[model samples]
Target: MTAKQRVIRVSTEQPTYAVTVLGTEISIDVNGFIPRGATSFDVRGTSGLRVYVIYNPKLVTKPIGAVRWPLNSEVEVIVASNDPSSVVNDNKVRVSYYGPTGETLIANAWLYLTCMAISLDADTSRTGVVESTANNKTKWTWGPHGEGAILLVNCDRDGPSSGNLDNAYPSVRSYEDLQDMSLMILSTQGPAGVFDSHKLLLHISMFDAGKVRVFHVNGNTSLSSYEHVLGSDKLSYAVKRSDGKARHSFFVEGLAFPDADFAGLVSLNATLLEQPSQDLPATPVFTDTVVFRVAPWLMTPNTLKPVEMFVCSIVRGQNTNQKFLEAIKILAKEANCKLTICPEVENRGDRWIQDEMEFGYVEAPHKSFPVVFDSPRNRGLKEFPFKMILGPDFGYVTREPKNGRISSLDSFGNLDISPPVTVKGKEYPLGRILIGSSFPGSGTRRMAKVVRDFLYAQKVQSPVELYSDWLTVGHVDEFLTFVPAPDRKGFRLLLASPLACLKLFKEKQKEGYGGAALFEGLGRVGRITLDEILADEYLRSDSRYVQSCIDWNRNILKRELGLSERDIVDIPQLFTLEHSSATALFPDMVNMLVLGKRLGIPKPFGPIIHGRCCLEEEVCRLLEPLGLTCTFIDDFFSYHVLSGEVHCGTNVCREPFSFHWWNILP
Candidate 1:
C-alpha cells in the first residue's frame, strides 16, 4: 500500500480525481471528503520564475487557494512526528514514509509537509508531449481580446524541489508566424509540498494588439509546448537519480527562437511559476517581468524603438513663423537619438504657419488641452511598422522614396514618412521626412498624418499650408462623403463646414462623431453586417468562402461573446447586417470566400488587390456588377498616414476614393 504514482491529468472532478500519476493505475478521493461528481476541482500548473510571468500569454499562478491543501481535501499523508506533540494543524499535514530501509507514497500533492522523517515518494512517469490548449486564443480577433482559466497541480513530495523536470512547450508570442519552437527546463529545489499550492497561467497578444487570448494548463498536462526557448547550443545530455529510489534529477531545457527580431518567447504556462509556499519572493514577481525565449518578431523588431518627439512651431503676435526657430531649439533640447526640426519650406513665412497646420496641432493656451498625451513620450500607437514599408502585397519594402534616403518612423519603429532627405553615397536608402514644429500629433501618433493625407487627396496644393492658412477642417472621408468629385456644389458645401461638413454629419447630432458611427452615418452605404446583406445562395455556393465567413463570424463575434457554435455559424441571426463593421476588411475577407465546400473561394482577381487597395469586398463585387474593373490598392495601408515631408502616397483625401481611405495611416 506504500507506493507512489504519477498520472496524466484528464479531468478533475471532486471525490474521484482521475489522473494517471507516474504511469500507475490508481484513483484517489480528494481527501475522501466529498462525494464523486459533487464538485469539480480545477487543475493548473506553473511556469518559470520571472517577475513578469503573471501577465504572459502562457504562464499561470496560484489556483483555488489553500496552496498546501484544503482543510477537507482527501489527501493521504503519512505524519511522522518524532516529538509526538507536533501539532497537525490545517497546514501541517505530512505524508508518512520510511527512510534508508523503506519507502512511502503520498497521493495528495501536499502530503509530505508534516514530515519528521519526510519525503513522501511517488512513482515517476515517462515524460509526455506538452502542448498549449490556449494557443488558439491568440488568433486575430480584429479587436482587443484575451482568455484565461485556473489550473492546479499536487506536489507529491517533501520540503525539497527542483524545476519542472518534465519536458514542456516553449512560450509563444504569435504562434501563427512562429517558424520553429524550443524547450528548456529549470533546476530548483524546495519543500516537497510546494507545487500543489502553485498554479499555472498563459496569455497571448494577438495580431498587433487587435486581440488578446489566455489559457491555463492545470495539473501535469499543463506543461506541454511551454519549454524554455534556449539557444540550441545550450542542450546537454545529462541525467541524475535521487537516492537511487527516486531516480530523477532537476534540469533546465532551453528551446530555440524562430523569429529574427523577437528577442524571445515567454511561455506563460512553463514560466509563470511560484516558489512553493516554503519559498516565496519578498518582492512579488509579476506575470510581465518573466522572460523566456527568443523568436522571430511577429509584430515589431525587438531592437526597433524610435526616439519619440513632438514637432511644434510657435506663432507669436500673429507672426507665428518667427517663433519656429525657437520651437526647434526647445524640441532639440528635449529629444534625443538625432532628429532636429529643420523644415525645408519654399516660403519661410508661409512655411512657419504651414508647419503649424501640418499636424493636427492647434495652438492654444492649454498645451495639454484636447491632446492625447503631454508629449512624444506618450504619443503614437507605439506599434506601427516603420522599419520597413508594407507594399502592395504586404511585402516589407524599405522606405526608398528618394534614390538613397532613409525614412523616419513612429515610436514602435515602423517607418512613418520618408526622412525628407536622401543619402547620395551610402549603399542603402536613407530617405526620410523633415518634420516641422507646427504639426500636431507628431510625437508618434498619426493624427497629423491622417489630416494631411486627407487634404492631399483633395489635390491640395501643399495641404499643410491649406490647413494652416485656410483653416480647412474635416477628414477627407467626412468632407467629401456627400460630395462626389463631379459635383462642384457638393464640394463647396464641404468647404463651408470644415469641422463636420454636411457630407459627414447632421446638425442635430453635430458635435463630431463616435468614430465608427460617424464613418457609417456619412458613408451612405448600408452596413453589411447590420443588414445581413449577403445573398442566401452564398452558403449554397460551391466555394468554401461561405463556411469561411461563418467560421470568421463565429470567432470574431461568437467566441468573443461566448455564443454557441451553432448560433455563431448562423450568421443571419447573429449580427446587424447593416452595421458598417460587417463590411470591414476582414469581413471582405469572407465575402470573396465561400464556405462548407472543400474547395476555396474563387476570387475573380487577387484578393491581394482587394486588400492592398482599400476596396471592400462588397465594393469590389459592385465594381464587377457595374463593369468597372479598377485595380486593387494594397498600398493604401502603407500610405494611410499623413506625410508632411511629401504628398501622400495615395490621394485618399481628394477625389472619389478619398472618402474610403480617410484619416487612415500606415
Candidate 2:
C-alpha cells in the first residue's frame, strides 16, 4: 500500500540519522515531514547536502527506564529520499541508535537544513581587479569571489616600540595605527571577556601621555561602558599640553593572557592618536597580532561560561560585530576567576537550519540567519561537530546486530507483546487498563499511577506481570546500581527524570506515532479497517496540526491497509506497530478490514489531545536540555517524575544498562 511518503520528525523524534547511501555519514531529511504541509517533494539537488530533523518538546514529565532514547540524539532513518525506489540497497545502511519497531513512519518530522553544495562555487579563473583599500589608499587588486570568515585570535603581539609607531599600516610596525576596526563576532553575548592593552599595561608604562581606560564597546550606542576592567594604577597624568598640544605621543600598550596559550585563543589590537587637535596628524595603523606581556589564565569550560540550560542566540548589533567579542580581560590577581564585563547591544534574531536539519548550519555569507548554541548536554559535539572537526553530517555508527536481535532503538529485547490482565486468556496486545494522558506531560506518570491504581482496583488478582518504562527512571537506576541485585526487584516505585521526556519524545518522533500508523497500515490488511488514538497533544508544538494528521490518516489507513493478505487478519504478528499502554482499538478493528473489510465510517480521526502547546513557553516551562532523567518511587504500578536524574546521559554509573520497562510502555 503506497505508505512510502517522506516522514518528518514532529515530536521528540530522533531527527538525526545515518545511512549507507552517503557512506557512513547520516543523510538528513531533505523532504519536509509535515503531512500535507509542503506542496511538492523537491529532491532535485540530492548530491551534497546534509539534512536531518530537530525535535524540541516543551515538557519532559516522563521517568527514566520508561524510555532510553537520548534527549536529543540523531537517529538515521531506513529510507533515503534521494533513491525513493530502494529500501535496502546492495550495501547495508547502518545507524547508531535506531531499531525497527514494526511501525515504519515517524510522526511530525521536519525537513532540517544542512550544508549546501557550496556557498561560492569558484570558477577558478581570475576575476577583473577591483579597487580595494590598502595602506589607506584605494588600489586595484585581483582575487576570487570565495571569502571565508578569517577568525584571528592572537594577532596582537605586544605593541611596537614608540619608534616603530612611525611607520604603521602596510609597512607599520606599531599596533597604534589603524584607520578603522570592525568585528563580526558571535560570542556568549552576556558579560564577555576583552583585552584592552592600554589599560592592561598602565602600571608598566613609564610615560602617561594619556592614561588608558578600558571600556565595553556597546554595539547599539557605539559607546563604551567602564566598570573597572583592569589597571588599578591608582593614579593618572594629563598630557604635558592639553588643548594646545603640538602633538601628543601615546604609548600603545599591549594585552595578554596570563594563563591560556596562544594555541587555543589569542589577542590582537590597533592604535589611535591622542585627541588629534586641529594641528595634529592622525596616528599610524598596523594590522598584526598584539604582543603584550605573558599574563595568562586558564579558561575551563565550567568557568567563564554560565551554568544554564543553553545559549539562546548571540544578538548581532547594528554597526558592530566587535561588541560581541571585544571584552577586557580582567584577570584576578588572587584567584583563577575573571569577572567579564559586557556592554549591551542590539538583539539579533535566532537563526535556525532549514527543514529536517538539526542545529541549523547553512553555508553562505548572507546576513541575518537564526542561530542557537544548541549544546544540549554537548551531544552536538560528539554527533555533529561540523565537517572539518568531525565532518558536516552526523557520523553513523553501524554495529553488527546480534543475530535475531529484534531490538532497534525503539524495540524491547525479547519482550512479551500481550497485555498483563487475562481476558479469558485471550492474550491482548496492549495492557488491560490504559492510564494515558496526551503529550509527555504528567501523562506518563499519570499512566503509571493510574495503571497501579487500576491493578490495585482488582487487588493484584489480574495475575499478570506489570510492565512500564519506569524501571529505567533514575530512582530505579540508583537502586539498580548500588543496591545488590537480590534487593533490586521489588523496588516499590520510581521517580522519572526530565530527560526521560526526551526519550519519549524521541520515540514518538522517531517511531511512536508513525509506528502506530504502520501497525494499522501493514497489519490486518483485509480485516481491520480503522485505527485511531488520542495523541494530538503529544505533538512538539503544533498540537492543532496533529489533529489534522489524525483526520487524514483515519481514512487513509482504512481504505489502504484493508487490502492485506488473509494471514495477517487471522493471526496477526504484532512485533511491529503496537505500543504497550494507551488505547488498543487498532488491532481489534483490523479484522473487519481483511476480508476486503471497511469500518463503515469514512473517517475515524477521533479522540484528539486536549492540551495547548507544551513547548511554546519553553523557558517558563523549564524545558532545559539537561541530561536530566526524572526519578521517583515505583509502586506496584504507581510512580512520580523527578529532577535528580534529569542529566541522563552524563552520569557514567552503569546501574541502568537495561530496558524491561519498554515492554510495558512500548
Candidate 3:
C-alpha cells in the first residue's frame, strides 16, 4: 500500500498516547488516526516507541520460523471513522502489516480494540502572581489562557490548606501576628488542553501583623479537607476545618496554643476536574519557615499566680438552697474574698453544680465546656486575682493538646474518682507551683505524665500524690488543703486529725454532751447515740485505714511541698457512720471553704453542744491563735453525707502570677 493508503491502529485504557518513530514523537487519539501521509515522529532514545494493542477476547499470535508473527512484521493500528458525526468506537482497531503479512492476514490476526490511547503531550506552562494584601487577604489571578484549571494554595507554617499531602506544616499560632506569612500556589492542566493554572509562591513573612491563614479559591469542596495545624516542636496535631465549600478558612485563634513557634515548610498539589481522565500535579510546592508569636501569658502556663488571697465561688439553684447560698455569701464577705453564686437547675442534682470539675481552668484562655458555659459558673473573674483552674476531664483526653501547645490529659484518668489537688512550692517562685496528689487505680499513669509534662512546659509543677485509698470521694481536699500566708511562698497546710477529734470527744464527754446526748435524734436514725454511731460498722471498719492515710499524707506534704510543723493546722473533726458508710461532720473542718486566709466552716449539727460552746466554737479557738478567721456556713443538704463539702460546692479563679512565669521559672 502507498503511504496515503497506510492504516495504523492504537488501543489503550489511558486517555493519551505517544507514537514515536526514528527521532520524532507524534500525539494521537482514537478520533484522529495518523494522517494518510504521516510517517516520522519525535523520539528521545535510540529505539522507537513500542505500541501495545488491547483487544476484547484478546488473541495470541502464532509463531513461525522461531519469530513472533506480529512482533517481527511492520504493522500499524488505526482507529478510523468514515463519518465525522459518528461516535468513535475505541474498542475497534484496523491493523495493516507491511512486512511478510499482507493486509487481509494482519486484519484477522487480533480482536477489536477495547480502549484507545489519547495524547497527553499538551503544553503545561502559564504565568500568574499570588498577591497578599496588608490586611492579610490573598488572591491569585491566572493568565488569559489559564482557565478551568485548579490551584492548590498552602501556607508553609500552616498545614495543607487543600487536600491531604505528604509534607507537614507548622503548628497554628495561637496569637495573631504575621511573623512568618507565606503562600505557595500549584497549578494543574485545564480541560482546554492548555496549562490553564497560575502558580505563585508569596514570601510575606511579616511579624506582629497576622499569623498564617489558609483558604481555597475554587476546587472540589466535597473532596477537599482543610487542616488547622497546631502544636509544639516535639508534638503536633491537625484539626480538620473542612466545611464542604469552595473556600476553607483557617484562623490562628482557632488553635489551642497558637502562640507557640513552628518551623517547617508547606505544600500544595493541584488536580484538574477534567473529563475521562483528570490532570493532576505529581508533587506539592513547598515554602520556608514561618514565625508565630503571642502574649507572654499565652506562652507560659501559670499555676501559682499571686493573689490577695484566692477567688472562690459556690453553685446554687435559684429555686433551691437559698439559705445555704445566703450563709456562704455572708461568710465570703467576712473573709473579704470575691465570691460568685453559680446558678443551677436543682440544688441537689448530681450534675447541677458540685461536679462541674470541668467548668474552670487554672490557666487563661480556658477551654470552653459547651454545656457548662450556659450554667452559672461562666461568670466573670474580675474580682479575683487569679482564675479558678479546672481539672482534666479524665475521659477520652489526649496527652498532647488537641489544637495547639496547650496540653491535655488522656481520657483514661477518672477525675470523678481521682482527687486532683495543687500545692505551691516554697522553692519555686510565684506561679511555679505543683499539684500534689495520688491517682486512684481508676486513672491511668499516662494522665500523670501528660499533666506533669504540660505543667513543666508551662514552668509550673505537676500535681502531687496523696492518700485516696480510704475515702469514697477520692479528692485531696477530702483530707487536706492549703491557705496562702503573708510570707513569700509560705502557706498553711490543714489536715484532718482523728486524734484531735477523739481528744475533744473525751473532754466533751466529761462535760456530759459527747455520749448518748451527742447522737440522739441525729443521722439517718433519729435515735442513734454517739457511742452507737462510732461503734457502727462504717466508722469502726475504716478508722484504722483512714488514720494510716492521714499519717502518710502529713509526711508527704512536709517532704514534697515543704510545710513545717508550725505551718500545719490540724482540724479537730470526728468521723461518723451513715448508711453503713464512713463520713465526716461539719467539724471535719479540713473541708472548709477557703478564701485567702478566711475559712468557711460548716455549722456543727452533731449532738455535742454546750449552748454556744459547740464544734463551731472549738474550731474558732483552733483557728484564732494562727491569726486565721473562721465563719460558719450551713450545709442543710448534708454535703458530707452526699460525698461532698463546702469546698466541692465551690470553685475559684485566682489572679495571674505577679510576673510572667518565664521571668521567675528561668
Per-residue lDDT of candidate 3, residues 1-666 (tens digit) = 101212333432223321111111222232233223222221111111224432233354444353223432233222322211111222232223223432222221222312111111101121122321111112211233321111111111222223221112333321211112222332211122111221222222333213333432233333133333322221222212221111222323212222134111221222211123246632212221222222111111212331222212335433245566677767666656566554332222432243333221222122111111111121233111112221121001112333433211221111211111224534344322323334446432223444334334433332355555345444555677665555433556677876666566556666766453443334453554455645556555556556666788788767666556887877766655444334674435666665656677766565546456355677777676656678776553545445566666665434434432223323
Model 1 agreement with the true structure over 1-666: per-residue lDDT tens digits: 122332212212211111111111222223343323232222122221000111222333333442332223333222222221121121222122222222222222322121111121110110122222223321211111312111111101111122221112223322221212212122222323323433222222332111111221222433343333222322211122112122121112222212222222333322223344556642211121122221110111001222322332323233233332443333333423233232323122222111221211111011100111111212221111121111111111111122322112211111112211112322111111211211233222233343223323322111112111101111211111111112211111111111111112232223422222211321333333211222323322312332343333234322222223322111111111222111112211111111111101111121122133112343344223322232222211121112211011111000011111111111
lDDT of 2 at 504: 31
Candidate 3 global lDDT: 0.36
Against the true structure, candidate 1 reaches a TM-score of: 0.20
Whose lDDT is higher: candidate 2's or candidate 3's? 3
lDDT of 2 by residue, 156-275 (tens): 212332221121212223232211111211111000011111111112122221222222222232222212221224232221211111221122221211111121122222221222
Largest lDDT belongs to which candidate?
Answer: 3
What TM-score does structure 2 among the candidates reach? Answer: 0.16
lDDT of 2: 0.20
**What TM-score goes with each of the models?**
0.20, 0.16, 0.46
Q: Where is the poorest 10-residue window by lDDT in model 2? A: 593-602
Candidate 3, residue 372: the lDDT equals 15
**TM-score-sorted candidate list, best first:** 3, 1, 2
CA deviation > 4 Å runs, candidate 2:
1-372, 377-383, 386-528, 531-666
